[model samples]
Target: MDKKSELRRDLVSGDWIVISESRSKRKHQFAKKEKRIIVPRSSCPFEDPQRSGNKLPILIYPEIGKWRVQVLENKYPAFKDVKGCAYIFKKGPYSVAEAVGHHDLVLTRDHNKRFDQLPLAEAELVFRAFKDRYEMHLNDPCVSYVSIFHNWGPKAGASIYHPHYQMIAIPVVPPDVEHSLDGSVRFFEKNKKCVHCVMIKEEIKEKNRIVFQNKNAVAFAPFVSKEPFELRIFPKKHIPYFEETSEAVLKDVIKALYFSLKKIAKNMKDPDLNFFIHTAPIKNKKKYHHYHWHIEVIPKTNIDAGFELSTGIEINTVDPDEAAKILKKN
Candidate 1:
């Protein structure tokens, strides 16, 4: 079967991913690469953001009358303001589009106290800022999606010694979100049930994969362990958008997130990890009630090798069942 820009189902999860034959990556040989050195804290640009010529912050939080975290435009942004209509330039068959989106960093008062170590209230405050900024960007005509994510430790892509999260709002629906949205739409069309809500119900029944749960949210190891110790936290209700998430649900989510991350921190001896929010596109949210939002945490346990990279399939060294056992024990 051929799909021009249609949704295709996955035999494994019975989910769907958009495969636009007309607009897709043409297979090519791998390019040459080089190793690079990590920047030291002393020379890290974010350590002294102002001195490094970063733009004035759009938002700032203070503690002890000093800067805790500030939301500033990325100094060397992937996206920047351009002339009318965010233009795209082309080089041969390749297309280069202006990253005409917003990239902001959320810094906590501490360069150390990793998110899991922060006071629950402080963590909640960080989330409050996340929601605030997300809403701000949602109104921007240029943005289609806003991604809020945290990279902890070196393994998870944190180049600096400091703990911070990033929010990037862009004009396009990212590939991951594209796949998830398609999945939920197909599920809803077929079963008339939300995919995530169904998964949560099944998880509750199996009593496996569950890491934690409270009145409003649930945390569990995903059925598909793209990487070992991967976890997804979701609101019990079938909320289509993250910005619409209630304050009460946010509090419980933070608790569940804190507990789950703390457990992984203990289990992996503080491995680096990347955690991010996955939700429906901000603009088309009304068309996505079946798209329940969630956070997925993938620990950087193993490096992506040749096969994993070439095929786009991640191989986990440890199994989910075993990972759950170890995390739960910790």
Candidate 2:
């Protein structure tokens, strides 16, 4: 086989990565992960959800009958249910804020339909709900960043057998996101281009890693993916804010995302995965014109162990080229 390698830049953090083909596994040795053991459908809490003792919906879409999607306060929440600003508590030299942000669970009608299994139309509706609830949380003056994500299996942190997504709005921007936004700003001041758009253009030109593309969006396993089967989806257009995107673009992006997830599931055999959107901050949308919004999907296959945690870096066990080969088959 020919020698292979790829140089990739982080859109938000402006970090360069090298995907070395020397680290790759052989094609015949590419093993598939087993699908997760789901909770029995009978014991599935989401089915006939009301009998399961879930609370009243905070925001309901249809406003009648069994809801497809319902926003509810998390029962055991990391962030307090009471809405309030972060309060600084002094503990010696260190200061910390009260975990006093909003935590909500967005539930869909399906008990068995994983996000990847959903029809594109249903998946788009889930994303629309995400944006809607994000705006609602921002109405509170304390909210700075909202995280929307899905956890597919136990290792990925999903406790229930039923399909659901989560959103947490915090008073402070997450540190990783902070570094990313700072990097984007720095890149803008220097090179004067959205880092994500630059990657998209290059990936489309190469077409080696691109798994799927629609009119408005494209999905690919990143050249420097931190995990085997990691995928990222970006709008072909330079979209600064997710909420600000037109309905047409949003729908297309969701389709691209849904299909990308499906391909991952089919090829990787239902590896537990998590995905979230990374975008500019709520305060300085104008200042982040150089930034672009995209989704990152990380499938949990390897444990971080000592090497990764100590080094503050990840080792991708399956080469991205192999990952793309697996993911592209669907």
Global lDDT scores for all candidate models: 0.74, 0.79
User: Which candidate leads in lDDT?
Assistant: 2
The digit string of per-residue lDDT tens for model 2 on 1-330 reads 765666665665655555555665664344454556768779887676557777777777668875777788787788885645788888999998888887888888887898867766677778878988888865677787888899988889999979989998887888988887888778777888877777899899989899889999999988768777789999899988888888888888888888888887777777788999987767655877877888989877667768667765566656676788878884
Using alpha carbons, what is the TM-score of model 1? 0.83
Q: State, as a TM-score between 0 and 1, how close model 2 is to the true structure.
A: 0.92
**Counted clashes in each candidate structure:** 1, 0
lDDT of 1 by residue, 1-330 (tens): 442444444422454333333432221101112222345567767777888788777777653377766777876566665544355688899987778887888877665678889888888878888888888987777788888999876656776767788898888888878878887787788888988888889888877788889999998876556666789899998888888889898888888899998987766666678999998898765988888888988876556678666766555544455467667865
Clashing pairs in 1: 79-99
Model 2 CA deviation exceeding 4 Å by range: 2-32
